[model samples]
Target: MKIVILGGLGNLGSQLAQTLERDHELSVFDRVDFDVLDENALLNILKDIRPDILINCVAYNAVDNCEDKKLYETALALNCELPARLAQLALQFNFLLIHYSTDYVFNGLETKKEFSENDTPNPINKYGESKFLGEREILKQAENGLKYYLIRTSKLFGPQGGSPQAKPSFFDIMFKLSQDNKELTVVNEELSCFTYTPDLAAATARLISSKAVYGIYHLINEGAVTWYEGALELFQLLKQKVAVRPIRSEDLTRPARRPKFSVLQNNKVKKLRPYQEALREYLNNL
Candidate 1:
């Protein structure tokens, strides 16, 4: 299969590229080569490549920064308008569209209840709202005969780093802090799965190949943990004696509101390994 991955230089995108390149023809488009906001470029690329699958990892994911009114236009363009346009192209070209969304679509009001694919989206912040809108656009296209898969994931982490486009994952930050012998401060109030990108990318390949029934699927590593706990586990894995301080979400004072508990229940697909096992594998590889 000929596959084109947008934002292919980023964390998850890079992993997808690496995973699928072995078995399929892959073309990766990053921000340097292709901008999601540039509709003409996007359209031309799609028309030229006409790939069997177009996996979009592109997103305006600076959570708190997305709340800024100044960034609203860019956010809407990348998070909503771009996907909608891609959906239109998918309809025209008849290619499978696989888009990544977030667990943030949920309000996180009910701490005890794990959100499933069937749960109604009630985004609490602009970032979540934008992602939810993206999902809606793709689903709308699916309704109109576009083959689409919306994978809602949370707390994505991976081992790939060092490139200018490579932003460190949460685990990376903790690992670096531990190396520096610096104390870590993490929010304990929020709970979500720490999905490993390699695992997600592998599962995605399987799902696409299997031709699974799809609309919205929660594709995340099994089990949930607070940020503080995740950090402690990282420290333990490293055998680093760095002190980790737990703080409430409110104490951080971020611009965007976060879901207190955005753990997604994987009902549709269940191929991913547990978060702890994934983390250990990543660490061992590193």
Candidate 2:
């Protein structure tokens, strides 16, 4: 299959490119190659490539920065408008649309309960709202004969390092702080699945190749943990004695409201390994 991966230089996209390229004809385009907000350019590229699958990894995912009113348009353009246009193009060009979403679509209030695909979305922040809107746009296109797959995930980490064009991930920050032997404080109140990019990339390849049911699915590692726990595990894996502290989300006072528990339940495709196993594999690769 011929695949076109947008945001192909980023963490998840990079892994997808690496995993899928083994069996598929792959063409990658990052923001430097073409702005996702540029509808004309995007359509032109899709027309030129004419891939069998268009996997969209592009997103404006600066969670705190997304709360700024001045950046609302930018967020909407990348998170919602881009996917909608891509869905339109998929419909026009007869290609499968695979788009990534977030667990932030949920309110994150149910700590003990896991969120399923059937749960209704009630995003609490602008970032979540925009992502939810993007999902809706894709579904709307589906209603008009667009073949699409929406994969909602959370707490992504990988061996590929942080996205150069985006903010560093939590794992990156914690690992860097460990090297300095400085005390690191991570939020313990929030809970979600920590996904490894390579595992996700593998599962994605299976789903698309198998021609599974075309709808929303949650793709993440099997278990769930808080940021503090994940950080501790990372330090232990590296055999580094870094003093780590646990703090509440409110104590940090971030610009955006985060869901306290947004762990996703993968019901459709359960090919991903456990979070700890995936993390260990990533560490071994490093």
* 1-286 per-residue lDDT for model 2 (tens digits): 8899998989899989989988999999887787778778987888888899999999988889899998977899999998998998999999999999999999987556889888889999999999999999999988898898899999888866245775556778888877876788888977889888888888899898889999998999987899999998988988888899999999997899999889899877764788888888877877
Write down the TM-score for model 2.
0.95
Candidate 1 residue lDDT tens string, 1-286 = 9999998888889899899999999989888886678878988888898899999998888898888998976788899998999999989988999999999999898656999898999999999999899889988888788898899999999877334767788998888777766677899977889899999999899898889986878889987899999998887887878889999998898899999999999987765888889999889988
List where candidate 1 sits over 4 angstroms from the true fold: 161-163
Clashes of 2: 0
Give the Å error, residue 245, model 1.
Answer: 1.9
RMSD of each: 1.4, 1.5
**Per-residue error (Å), model 2, residue 121:** 0.8
What is the alpha-carbon lDDT for the whole of candidate 2?
0.88
State the TM-score for model 1.
Answer: 0.96
In model 1, how large is the Cα lDDT of residue 9?
84
Model 2, runs deviating above 4 Å: 161-163
Error of 2 at 110 (Å): 4.9
